[model samples]
Target chain A: MDQRPPDHITAAPSLAAKPPIVTLDGVSKAYANGTVALRDVNLSIGRAQFVSLLGPSGCGKSTLLRLIAGLGDLTGGRIDWPGSAKASDGTPKRDLGFVFQEPTLMPWANVFDNVYLPLKLGRLSRKQARPRIMDALAMVGLEKFERSYPRELSGGMKMRVSIARALITRPSVLLMDEPFAALDEITRFRLNDDLLRLWAGRDWTVIFVTHSVYESVYLSNRIVVMGARPGRITADLAIDAPYPRSEAFRMIPAYNEYCRMVSAELHATMGEASPE
Target chain B: MSTSAEPVAQRADRRLIALRIALPILVGVVFLGTWQILVTWLQVPKFVLPAPSLIATAFVDDFASLMGSLWFTLTVTVEAFILAVVGGVALAVLFSQSEIVATALFPYAVILQVTPVVSIAPLIIIWVGYDNVRVALLILAWIVAFFPVLSNTTLGLRSTDHNLRNLMQLYGASRWRILTEVQFPSALPYLLAGMKISGGLSLIGAVVAEFVAGSGASTGLAWRIIEAGNRLDIPRMFAALALLSVLGIAIFGVLSAFEYLMLRHWHESAVRREN
Candidate 1:
């Protein structure tokens, strides 16, 4: 609440002006073995913001994403879904969809069935959910391969199926944990475009976890850079670069400038706590 | 040249299929011919070693009784196999319900698996009442067949992908929904493998239990084999033994076909790679 947030919560001056959808107050997670995965992570994300939690390995970016999605319990502090978007459970995290590092698909099921799972679990009938499933798959460009099994699909295709599945419920928030890390560069770039295209003009919030700073700068409007060794946010950046960013943007000077700024902020934080 | 090339490829494909079928039959024919010639030339006694020709005659001669015995054996085997499939899968589902339950019950299944069926056949017959000998045969066969299904299915259920389970959890799926939608389908390949193994064990159980239970209470192929051996009717024994082999192979074939059909879409073992 200070006029200037303590040095750790640097950046995000523009974020503080917008109404926050989610607020984390002194959130901390510690395992039973006495390892503090995250410590006192104070942050707020506005509605429809594509916020990237970017850090190197062991930075607790993944843990932070999991906690926000309600997949894991935080040992201390709390997270609040402050917007009117509190899904029926009084927390949007329960209703938020997730895309893991792996496609994490049920191999036995076809593309249609895989995409249909969350709806099916919610007790929606196949006939009723067919249109939504098809729409989700088509949005990811996989409608024609609805009958294809996960085994038959390539790595990028599998990730697309995973994206389709995550969006099938039309969740207000989607959490992606390094979803495109395993993909080839060409495939990753295409998927990044496809993902941006999907998130554009939508009201959904996406919290993406990534180790790559360029990925963070390219994909997210707001980047919350964190550091390892009792993980906490070191900087919160708002990439002011305009949308409809394409291959041309990657070659532009402004994009490079933003990446360099995020990169320096990231390295500065990593240098302080990192053992190496 | 392209038109001719297609026909050439089709003809070669047909020849490959023909060879697969013909090769095994060729080996069987050669072995049987050698046996027949040796038996006839050496003037071997039919009581000591029945030639393939003599076995054939006995097959024709006792065709009526053999048919009856075959039907009875097949009936018991099928009944036991069906019971094993249902009971094993059901128990596996129950075991998968709780880790404590699986731990508590798994040892008994292992005991049944390890303790030879032959050792327990007489006891099962006695316990079920000697008059309920057919029921005894069914239970013994079921025990042998059920273990694989129960063990394999539980393994499959346990090995459901961790991330997928987490995904289901995130979606607010209930225990039942997770089991039916994710757990069961994931365990299917393992379940099918168990069924194939159990199918053969069912027949073995029926025959072995009958052998121990003695020939009096039933008229299955096992009873036929014992009766022929006691009378030194070796040709009839060979005929019964042949039926048993054929029956075992048939059950394996059916189960394998079912497995392929179920898993060809996704399972690595069942899919045709070249295609």
Candidate 2:
């Protein structure tokens, strides 16, 4: 393995904050069609840690995220919450925010209503959610687009709204599934920076899924590179760099070095899959 | 997108709108002119087909009698339409909930529609007697026109965005709330489109039933058409036909306008794009 620090590796923040709050044990997933998507995978996520599930396509990264969110039931294994583990928490997994590959917004709804959907569905009335919705919209830099419909929005803005919706719930664990893959390069870059800033500010545990190595390196503190064809974890690279990452960091030699290493790893992973 | 020709563009747009409005009127005038020429030139027998001017004169001369029949027809059409809407939607909601029952009864609805109104109107008139015969006839007409609306609306409800449906489910929206907020709103355009089609259909049904009624009940435009035909008032018959045609067009136009207004904000179908 290459030893150079990732160019976009964020600076190590003070660890006095917290330890990992989430634990998964022997998580094996098999579809109804007898296709095994994940097998005996184990992962533990820390509080406020941004973990990128970096992998080739069909890595079951998204499925794993869904299992965590309680959107999907695991065929085997258990997701344990240390502090809040209980049988009687009436609050559903909907409280856990999920950003899908597509924005998955209600096309009929305006930005404000779409942002407020979760909260409103949680039994909060429109009046109660007005300020919170506005705040979320502002968090995503879409303050001026409250009345705009999804069809009118650009892909980046729509994804931002999705992010805002995920954030609006103040979710402890945010699940993202390649939300920015559809965007152009420039838009993706800006969104990446915005995402990091937001992640830093909120201190929420984020489990992100992406096929892009540069993206995984840029935003993740821990990159979980996965392999497909009956998905399995191949590598987990920890990113140790400084925070408040700027556009300048992407240009540094270290950043390029990390990109090359990840690219090589990805290329090798693809080659290995071809023969099998 | 340039601002320089904005006002000029605005003028051109308004002119375009005016032309769109004028084109239909121009077409109608031309159509009437051709019809009048054909009748006059061919010396088509007046009893068979009267000229437009003759029809107009007959309409004015028999205004009092025609007005009474028109009122009756209008009432039946309105009543039948209202019943169709209220009953169709209620049944649709019921049917949407139970797939088994919906499947069982949907074929029956089709059977009801396919069974000719003439065959049923006479039976209904006899069963209900004279005073309520017209209403019975109207109901017969309505049943046929209503099935499309119900089926279309239910399909629309069923076809709502899966993401939105999941979102609602995640939020733990109650069945009633989901139905009202998501399913119903999504179904509105489809329901309205069906209504536009059924509006004209219901009118025709009412008229046909009235024609079948002969003279026992004078409820719809069909009776007037029959009366004029029986009396050999050819121009009066044309006048009645014209009124029926205009009424059908007007009903459809009204429903379409309502659809446009309702969907203007939310649906792409109703959204007007800049020229």
Candidate 3:
């Protein structure tokens, strides 16, 4: 339990200390059926920052994450990856990892092979990629389950494998879409702690999507609360909680205050969408 | 008490295994015995329904020539099965790559599947020439066997987990890598299922084609059965039929074993669940 607040929040002279790694300018997504999923969204993600897109379902939090990952074609506006633009051939820069809402493990493959997937796609031989694959499985604390298939694992373990696979590429940015939303509370808490530790150990940025106010407050250095009915960002609040935030931090008054603030902003957005 | 219970459980397991083998064998023995006794008591003519004993003696008496014909049929069935698998999988992969190609070609594949091979066997025989009748039979059998592979594999390829596809896209995975590592492995159970159905269908196609061809000395087990029928050698016909049934069972057994071996560790259908 490292009781230190995130170094980026407390240590920086200004909030904009680091240059933006990714910039989403006036982004909008409207399906062909005339449903507006997102509208005029503007956000900048700084290097190594843990940002949570916190909102109710249909607030396009997941959609926003997908747009950042280049999974979907944005209906409007531009997404710029300043560092990744150097290798520009118009393909979304391959320097980002995405973890879906589901564990999404290839049910046919074992943990080792699943984690080795990105490397295999890159044409790295098994002999060349073995160490990195083992390292990733070890990072997720699944080294002993290397040969175990996804079907044999518990829900928490599967999500851990998904995280390991996502981290294997060692991307500059990691985009997660409500990962661990399916897990039980105890498992979720354990994962939240583990995620923070991993964040502290690395220099990569994380853009996490979640509907849980407590989760957003606990994990993120910055929480961007979103609203539905033509999805848009309703509030941008910083959780100045120190890391490594442990089980003890969850009991503190400041943690409750941050949760309340996020919850109030979300309630305000939801109320605005439906008058009744 | 716990130690005593362990051996009791082990004994039960051993008995279950024994029953699994013994039950089917016992039923088969009872069936043969009843048929033999009934036929002998009634003084039934062999032409109508040969007794199990007569069929067995016929099987031994004509063993050499019957085996030669069995070998011929097996070769054709095996060849047709191989071609069906290869062609079906190749086409499925092609379909997976291009929607336009699939749309253009898939209906024709369905048409081929629906049309009876027996009706087309004569045309194939004519086109391929009497000397290459085996090739004609092979083509007809392939037609019967290839569709399940194509349709099932295409479904499997298309049904790849969307999240996994998105993850692959996030990594900028090449088309080939995605196909081999993701789509192909996902399609394994479906492909094996198609193979099993096609295995049986291929045998039927070969036999049907041989029946239609009616080439006397040069043909397969089906031709032997046809010749025996013309001669009213019902016992020999029953013997040939028995051989064909055995071949079908053997084909099914081999395919099932393969499916189990491939999917035992991961697939839901193959892995045993305690609950």
Candidate 4:
């Protein structure tokens, strides 16, 4: 009761107030099969903001995330990394992290080796990258399991290793596509908390894709609810929840309110998607 | 109940292990015993159907020459196996790198694999010449052993997890790094499996090639079997055949052990699962 919420913990600041790190202008993606995955997705992500692309399965949230990561080419549009110090060939920023729906750890490699991948690709010697790799693993509390292979770890542990691997590069942007969807409830809740802690302690921009309204409500400062059948942004709601959010936050009325708002928007989108 | 059942489970495990060893030996004994008994009871001629005891005696009697021939066959088999593995894996890596090259070369590999070694042995001997008959045999063995490694490894390399491939791409991994770090490790189990099949095939190829070469060239175990047959030394022929079978088993066992050593840590196929 003595603690106060942070001043910035209000609605997402307007574009004018916050400096944009990346801008997606008229971004449209059409598959070779004539499927319009995303259409004219005009959005600007501010630096270090926790943004969630919340939608149903077919809403192309994952597609949008992939676009940002430069894993696939956009049919028509441009992504600009404004004020980026690094090279811009319209490829994924070299220092960005990506976590797929699966843990995506190499089955052959132990946790340490898996975490070392990005650094290894960066041409850092194993000995040189060892300290940073250890630090990243320690961040995810997987320091002890460094020698354990992916098959030996539990589902949640594998995901943690994945997160650790992503963080190893100290990436400015972390793009995750339904990373916790495969996990059980308890593990998912714990990971959500852990992810928030990591995010709070760092200045990393996160673009998380998920269909879960509750998850979107709990983690994100701004939730961009997307609609299918063309796949365009339907609503952008900001949850003004304070951080250092604990298990107690789930009990608060505001949390439920945010969840309800997201769910309603999602339901409306789904309704519009299907007609009798 | 859990505490009490623990000992029972341990006992059952021990019993299972014992059975695993015992059952195979028991089957072998019964099989040999029936063969010995039937040969004795029917008063069968040794040339037509040698008894187990006669075969054992003949094996010892012809041990020196048989051992030499066995060594010759083994050397050829091992050399051919090594060549197959090297050639197959190299070609597979090349195929994985270029779709056009793979499209051009893959059909010939398939053709080589589908063609029986028996049919090819005579032509190989003629082309390779009697002076280099062993080289002809080696070539034939290599042909038999190469295809599985190529096909399996190609499938495995191509089957690198899409997500992992995307992850590597996200990291801006070089194609070489992607191959060494991701594709190679993924293909290892498949390559090992192919090697296991190739091990047995290599031995068979060596034996078949030697059989076709017949009488004149290097006297391998297959040639010894042919010689024994011509002279009505049926027991010696049986002994040589037994040695060939043992060599095949030994090759398979060695390859399987290699596979286990390589993959036991990570691969689901090699990892121990709890029931």
Candidate of highest DockQ: 4
Question: Cα deviation in Å at residue A46, candidate 3?
Answer: 0.2
Where model 3 places Cα greater than 4 Å from the true spot, the runs are A1-17, A88-92, A272-276, B1-14
Model 4 scores what on Cα lDDT? Answer: 0.89
Q: What count of clashes does model 1 give?
A: 0
**In candidate 2, what are the lDDT values of residues A1-276, reduced to their tens digit?**
444545455333332135656778999999999999998887777877888888877888888877776666889988777755453664433346778888888767899988987887677899999999898899889999999988788999999999999888788888888989999999999999998888886767888999998888788777777777778777666676567777888888766666666666665666642211
TM-score of each: 0.93, 0.88, 0.94, 0.92
Pick out the ten consecutive residues of candidate 1 chain A with the lowest summed lDDT: A1-10
Q: Is the docking of candidate 2 incorrect, acceptable, medium or high quality?
A: acceptable
Off by over 4 Å in 4: A1-16, A88-92, A271-276, B1-15
Error of 4 at B177 (Å): 1.0
Angstrom error of the Cα, residue B188, model 3: value is 0.8
| Tens digits of per-residue lDDT for model 1, A1-276 | 122223332367676568877788999999999999999999888878999999979999999998888788989999988765555666664558899999999988899999988888878999999999999988999989999999999999999999999999988888999999999999999999999999999988899999888888899888999999989999888887778888888998767767777777787887842222
Q: How badly does each model clash, as a count of residue pairs?
A: 0, 7, 3, 0
DockQ of 1: 0.82
Model 3 chain A scores worst on lDDT over the 10 consecutive residues at A4-13
Q: lDDT tens digits, residues B1-275, model 4?
A: 48988899889889999999899999999999999999999999999999999999999998999999999999999999999999999999999999999999999999999999999999989998999999999999999988888899999899999999888888888889889999999999999999999999899899889888874677899899889989999999999999999999899989999999999999999997767
* Two-chain complex of model 3, DockQ on C-alpha atoms against the true structure: 0.80
lDDT of 4 at A225: 86
**Error at B82, model 4, angstroms:** 1.2
Better of 2 and 4 by TM-score: 4
Model 3 chain B is weakest, by summed lDDT over 10 consecutive residues, at B211-220
Docking class of 3: medium
